[model samples]
Target: MRRHRHAKIVATVGPASSTPDQLRALFLAGVDTFRLNFSHGVQADHAKVHAAIRDLEKEVGRPIGILQDLQGPKIRIGTLQGGRLDLQAGETVRFVLEGADGDKQAIPLHHPEIFDAVVPGQELLIDDGRVRVRVTGPERTSITAEVITGGPISNRKGVNLPGTLLDLSPLTEKDRADLAFGLDLGVDWVALSFVQKPSDVIEARGIIGDRAGIMSKIEKPQALDRIDDIIRLSDAVMVARGDLGVEIPHEDVPARQKELIRACRLAVKPVVVATQMLDSMVNAPAPTRAEASDVATAIYDGADAVMLSAESATGRYPVEAVAMMDRIIRSVEGHKLYHSIIAASEPGEEETPPHAVATATADLAEAVRAAAIVAYTASGTTAARVARKRPAAAILALTPNVATSRRLSLLWGAHSVLTEDVDSYEEMTTKARHHAQDEGFAKPNDIIVVTAGIPFHSAGNTNNIRLMQI
Candidate 1:
């Protein structure tokens, strides 16, 4: 089934929607991609879900993308006595870097890098910022801090360092193992978490090679410092706003999200705005008006896909969440200002061949009133560029690699299909014409524009554009 809207939906699968039937229902409900979060599930659990998604893909006769989000260096404070304790405000606490022994006065902080990385006056957030502490420098192998907003501190709650740039690898040992397993399972994308610099992306790319497209998760403030470089190296980027909200001021997320979307749009990389989008649907039957507006705003800002984390992963209304998000997108796209909103992006950037061709594709289609724009690519780059235009007609991306086709499924206005390799330019147009007609995107006398690089199968060589009649 074709989507009525341009933007895509990425639904995460978990215990709430792991069965093949449930996954297929989600697909029918307008989920374009399935994200298997490796943070909570075991390899065996993911293996089952991966197989199920693939099976559903075959049954639907459409390419579906699977993204394995790697859990980065997640720091947590060790347990307190009686498994919990109440620390009042203004209480001084000692956080040790080792041993799981501690009381209300002190606690075992498992991640030593936190002690080595943080300095005096930096804030540490625990339990998702419910408890806050201000550092007072280190004390031997521990760090002393005064609780700024103390409450009930529990065992093994997550910790967040707002501005501390830790000497931590984006791929932890567990992440490496999880990535290897997901790659072996043939996942379409791998999202690297807590990426601090371009080198982190380079390292993940070196290990990943071409096995899977690396999706860098932008959550840390440090990641914001090198977003351009990170976008340059990675295949895609996810604006992970949960931790990002903690790492930076809550009000700054909107501006930063817009900045990231614009940057990715300029580069023609797929960007997903994730974390708590439609989160209230986890238990409720419908989302609040504010949540509805939030989803609409992301689409209005041109995020390729808006993600549903807990809402789809473990929500009681998984299908409703997908359907709701789909409705919100379609409703926004139906607005008269949708196209104009997309047209308001920054326009002073230098143009490349691909950019020129993409801009020309949209203009050419309008000039000829063409049926669609067909892009033949190897890495889906050309199709993504074309999609960045938010063309008036559909964008068909034909690729020989199934993984490329699947990954392209998440792109706005991009309908990915696996096809035979095109060895010559003539074959490219002829095949595109036939597919366009066969796929019902065009009629016998319809005019359509075709774009692809010469020297077939070579990536980033989109120098050829043809306007053809089927």
Candidate 2:
């Protein structure tokens, strides 16, 4: 099957549509990637979906990308004993770590991590900011708070700490287990949620052990602050605008999304714009014009992928949402400016070791009108950098790492091949050309760009470039 020219569409799977037949319909409807959210389902359910996707891939004779998103640390309040508590404006309430024992007025606060991070005068928003609490005590476990415009306090409502840097790692024990389970399933990508620093990506990758590509979710303000470092460290990124909108001002989400797309493009890492792209379609058959424009904007901004959350996963119109997203992407790609934006936003050569070589090779590819650019990367970093330029020729990313290969498959204009390590650039180029010709991707006389690091077996040292004639 031929690949789509524009950015790919990633449809999430949920209870509304998790069957094999539904997944096949989504694939046929132009979903290039499937996202499995570990936050909602059990391991067995995810396994079923994985097996179904593989079966469908075999049936369709094309590789499909699977992204497993680990639920990061989700902070929430403890159980409410009185069921629901209400407080008037400017009323003082104590948020204690202990359970509510027949307390009709106050609710218990769980998650001691929050207590450790919160200081006096810090704002705590519960239930998506429906209930606001201001820390007014010694900032200890027994912090005092005055409920500001409190509503019905349900059981275990989520807590959002805006502008407060909690001293907590993004990955929880649940996330660690989920990461392990995802690796066992052999997923192509593992998307870590609420990533704040590059260290989170490193830690997640260490646990994944090169078994899956790390896709960092840029949803928190802290993540935005360290975006460049995170981009350099991650294989892919997602503009997770849902919680981001909640954390930051909603008006700022659009600008942040654009900035994130540009950053990832410059890094040559695949970027996905996700959440509420077609939110209305969750219940309605058609999408609002605003939602349609949002999807188009991501495509025009040169994102490698656009995702559907509740719309395709738990929505009433799963198939229709996927079809609509496909239509929107195609329509946006038809514009002449789409290709121009992609080409113009291409990443320049990094001054770093292998980046310099990859840039030189990319320059030669453009000059020689090469049939393709071939990059040998164990970590998939070099290939990703080459792809950022949005070259006219396709990228044949050769990697011995299976996880890297599968992850690269979802990137724009990238075709991954699994092969053994080559001793030299010459051997790498020869094998690349052979593979290209064998796959009917190149002619014997065509030119090809080859790039690899010196002393090849060493990881993350891509420092060589060559122009070869097939």
Highest-scoring model, lDDT: 1
lDDT of 2 at 302: 79
lDDT of each: 0.89, 0.81
lDDT for each residue of candidate 1 in 311-421, tens digit (9 for 90 to 100) = 998999999999999999999988999878888874344378777877788779878989989999898988987887777688888999898999998898898889999
> Number of backbone collisions per candidate, in order?
0, 2
lDDT at 80, model 2 = 64
- Candidate 2: segments with Cα more than 4 A from true spot: 81-88, 101-104, 352-379, 396-401, 417-470
Candidate 2 RMSD to the correct structure: 3.4
Best by TM-score: 1
Residue-level lDDT of model 2, residues 1-470, one tens digit each, is: 54545468899999887999999999998888899999899999999999999999879866788999988987777776656667566888777776554243445776787778878888888787778878787455577877775776677778888877777787898888888888888899989988988888888877876677789998788888889999999878999998888889999999998899888887778999999999999999999999999999988787888999999888999999999998898787777777677666664556776666666776788888898888888877788777666666778878887667667667776777778989865687779889777655679788888887778887778777777787
Give the clashing pairs for model 1: none
Where does candidate 2 have its weakest 10-residue lDDT segment? 98-107
How much is 119 displaced in model 2, in angstroms? 2.5
Superposed Cα deviation of residue 98, candidate 2 (Å): 1.1
List where candidate 1 sits over 4 angstroms from the true fold. Answer: 346-350
Residue 391 of model 2 has an lDDT of 67
